[model samples]
Target chain A: MPCRMTSLHQLLASVLMMAGLVGPAAAEDPNGARRKALHNMVVQDCGSCHGLTFKGGLGSPLLPDDLEGVDDSTIATIVLDGVPGTPMPPWRGLVSESEALWIARGLKAGVFQ
Target chain B: MNLLRGLTVLIATAVWCLTAAADTALRGTGDLGVIIERADGSACIISTTERAILSCVDGLGDLSHASAVFSPDQRYAYIFGRDGGLTKLDLLERKIAKRVIQGGNSIGGAISDDGTLVAVSNYKPGGVKVFDATTLEQIADIPATYGSEGKLSKTVGLVDAPGRRFVFTLYDAGEIWMADFSKPGAPAITKLGTAGKLPYDALITGDGRHYIAGLFGEDGLAHVDLWAEEPVIERILDGYGKDDPAMPVYKMPHLEGWALAGDKFILPAVGHPELLALDAVTFKEAGRVKVHSQPVFAIARPDGRQVWVNFAHPKNDTVQVVDVPSLKVVHEFKPGPAVLHMEFTPRGHEVWVSVRDADRVDIYDARSFEKRGELSLRKPSGIFFAARATRTGL
Candidate 1:
């Protein structure tokens, strides 16, 4: 009875989220088309140096394992203000703070795929 | 008993010597080809004479932006991996002869004109390290640091020119320096100041007269005449992209793939879906051809009649072939998803293209534009030929 009740609750939550009734924060990305484009950029453009599969290449790995100790804020900072004296160029001019934060969180959650 | 034992030892020695002599005879210029693969960092030693793939060897690490420089004889190939692994592979044995981790990160490398020295451009330590070509021993180290502050800068556009000089651009320093190795000991450094804001990549003219550096921070390119008495730096295509809004550059385009067809130089316009034609003699823009997306490589055919161009991600599947004379896109084809590289055979009879997402390399007849054959590979990218050894700055 308890398991059934938990399943019902989870199903209701998913339905609400899909219906845009829950998670109002997701609506912050005003343009759905722009968000899709950014997601593709994260996968393909970032994939250039970080490996197509997001394993690692000329740049370090962005997988959850490699980014374990690094927090989302620190990751966001590095993405916005790149590390100096390195091949990583500054993306602050191109990536906004909100978009950078979204990228960092997504990378931490292994969303590159 | 002593006589019998002596005879057996003599027989064994004779057989070993005969096998060694046979191997030496089989290894020649005829048995030369290059196989570039990124399926877990490995290469297949190809036999050009037989026109077939030979042996596949493993252990090349992190092959993103990977490149190989062949020896003068084309017997040994020095593969530079993205992880700073410099592996010397012997084509005869189909194995790695020697390997060393020169730095924590490396972009690419070049070999001296005489084939005596091998130099690598590093990203981690931000310098150029030269090694003995045969022995793979470190010979010299030149850190890319300038100004009174001694700040180290990431090096790019590393290439070897005539007169025993190695030239490269410093990203952070915004300068170009030539390391003259004509004399012994430390190389004489000539710092040609401030090439541009960000010189991403560069290539020497096929004639080996000019070294052009592509700028990322600005609209123009920095041009240096290697043979000039003072080697003055000139900027070309000034205000090329000044009027246009910046497009999202998913991957940086390499200027090394810029093609020189007759009097014209076919180059990708930065952050633009167009390919610009520059006059090789005047170093000025001649014309432009619109393409599918931002061009990655504008490679010219051997006869210099046409240029085959590929685009950056999203539009990578499409390839446009431009007729040099008219400066028009003559043909457009979609080979497959994630097209990575294209290479023409020595005589430009057959052109090979790598379709990474499709797991096949398509070979097309140069003139008729018909599919000839295909080679199955795992995540294939660059298709280098043994003929590259005959040229400079490959």
Candidate 2:
């Protein structure tokens, strides 16, 4: 435990250093007009666990086929309240109500493209 | 070259269709024995067909898609709406005498051998509805231990024992119910929790002490010793994998089409898509063999020598015959649509099946296993005959 803790501290130090180098520039990076804004935020945040493209590297993929008949309101509830007995967690406290709806709309429309 | 290839493919398809059409040769021996279907508030027996009979919509009234029970004497048919309504009809009069609202979807009912009491499993809310066979009066409505929300597919098989006693399968709570209707008021239903997944249906042995249940949710069979204080259960064959983490096929090994053959039970396995034989007393896996792909139901002859099953593909939505002794599929009958549920008429010549998706129950000739005719319904699911054939003819 002692040796593993030392190495984990080193890994955290390196991650912090990397974040310092790149963090300031990304804060104000405006989402492209072509893409919905909230959808871009979801790609950046949710992609932390789900893959960036949402094709699911660490978490399950939110594929178009998977979201087949799912609508915006259901997605909003899934995003805000989270599905019980699943890996999804409530994003309501951290995210604004408008952000959730925007992301859900984009999820539906993006599947078409 | 492309044009030539397309022409070849077209020619092949034409030949295949022609050959398939020829294979739909209707074959079977037996006529309509007795019919049971849902009526206004109960089950009714409006008509009988010796050859192949169809449900006459004009006369039977709003009795589409009901569970019909025929009397042992073949004089009356009890009809009920599996959705909560039960009824009794005089076979000769073709009119409903009594009707009552019954709750439970996928609910099943059974009549005593002497035709005095009829009990139905209220599947959704988890209760049993007992009625007087002669007058079609509600005698009792007994519920199970923990309350069950009437959302899942419950109340499937209500098998009758002598003295107005019976067993029922609960879909979600993972239990089978034992109840005796000799009581006047609320019939007390004892929970026989054969703790596995949900048990879809069951077949009681001739003596009615032991029960073999088709264990859903897993690749196995649940053998319950119903005579004991708590049913002694032996779980065999758990085949569902973990890839389906949520909404898994836990309760949908979905094997149906079972019948008791002598001291052995014959059932299809959804995992293996094959028929299995287990000892009624010992609960040991006796025989395992294949019959159809995604086979759902089966009906056996009283002799247990032959069994018929529903098998489908776009090519053959039909009934396949199995020689139970050999456990081999020997014949096929092309009935319209998919055969969801079936029961052999007492006459032995016919097997009536509810074409679930097609919204009708088609009738077939038993011996040849061929489509004799059908009964049109809105969306029928369960089926049963009044009694075993009184006199045999096709």
Candidate 3:
């Protein structure tokens, strides 16, 4: 295996930044609860297995750094199309485009309901 | 006809919804490509060569060094401590759900062989947080010292004891603690006499009366008699002696990695740097195996034939191989630098090695020691693998 020296904390922070949830927690949304609700839905519904608080459980840690900068459209595709060859099943028919956006934005906001 | 068709549409949507949720819940890290168990009950190997991170419970404070082994029971991997912090990873929805910060930088943790209790090693403030495996709710907090020790300094390992209290050792400090939780609130801790120098990790024999720790400051391993009112240190390894290397700067000898094999204690030495066998009873040297020139971790494989070692590897990388019965190096390779920790899955099939400096995890086949898959993650330390979670039964 290739020996690569790296700091996990720095690497994780960077991944979160790339995910677009970086930079001072997104200015603390004026409608915090509403946004949190959206985020919380993902946790309550999805977290039943993954984890309630973020970072992980049955699911993987969806750090903000990984989701940042990607357009909502792509996020929608991931939810709708789903990543294959893994456990992630597609949410296409079950979730509407807007619903995926809600989860994406909640993911972006970094606050769970 | 219209109503019937409408019902069919609703049913189709429901089925898709269930599949979607199940699949999403079962989503693969999809990135690592490692074989996390597939839907068919067969193993599916991922193409990547990086190993996966095995974080038990990751603490927030300096005790973050404290970690617990995580199970795939859809629960958070908690960093053990007095009030430990929980590591929340949701593999299904594919994201970190949330971090439930708890208390204490407790030491080692044990999930009953059947994965029932998350037994945490509470050091100073000695106690174990018995949480409902599935609910994450604190069911019982069993303590050693009859609940007297301050708090363990993030260096304890716990083992399962049916009739007696589970056993644990305070690695940095010098003490082995045992407490029975079968009755809960009134758990009594038996503090064995301090044995060995800076006694760290220890193991209780199958009978549960004998305990031993690899002494860091001392010359060899020490034996603790758990059956006695106060545990007694009855044994030491005649491996090598600490000597002055002429220069004023002392080359202090240290010891680590003491594993259990049948009824014998397989202890490794620092000076001679050899793997020596100790007769648990007479506390006499039973046999010796001259191991790595710079032997550090002399981890004996379960079969008692091969002791895997990282004697030589690149700087910050680990070069490991299985030392067979004849003391021959079976499989060898440079998995990565600073191969800090090596753990084999229960079945002894996959050897998950973590390259702390490499910021990567590498998985290899135990038999072949061939690189099977890999995980490219940020700071992939304390790597762990839960029984593969699949995209079904959402």
In candidate 1, stretches whose alpha carbon ends up further than 4 angstroms from where it belongs are A1-45, A51-106, A109-113, B1-32, B47-51
| Each candidate's DockQ | 0.16, 0.02, 0.02
Write down the lDDT of every candidate, Cα atoms only.
0.78, 0.54, 0.48
Q: What is the TM-score of chain B alone in each candidate?
A: 0.91, 0.70, 0.64
Candidate 2, lDDT over the whole model: 0.54
**What would the TM-scores of all predictions be?**
0.80, 0.59, 0.54
On a 0 to 1 TM-score scale, where does candidate 2 land against the true structure? 0.59
Q: Top DockQ: which candidate number? A: 1
The TM-score, computed over Cα atoms with residue i paired to residue i, of candidate 3 is 0.54
Q: What's the lDDT for residue B24 in model 1?
A: 69
For residues B283-345, what per-residue lDDT tens digits would candidate 2 score against the true structure? 666676565554555556666777777643222256677777666788865555545467766
Who wins the lDDT comparison? Answer: 1
Candidate 3, chain A: TM-score against the reference: 0.54
Arranged by TM-score with the best first, the candidates are 1, 2, 3
Q: For candidate 3, lDDT tens digit of each residue in A71-103?
A: 767876876776553334465655566667656
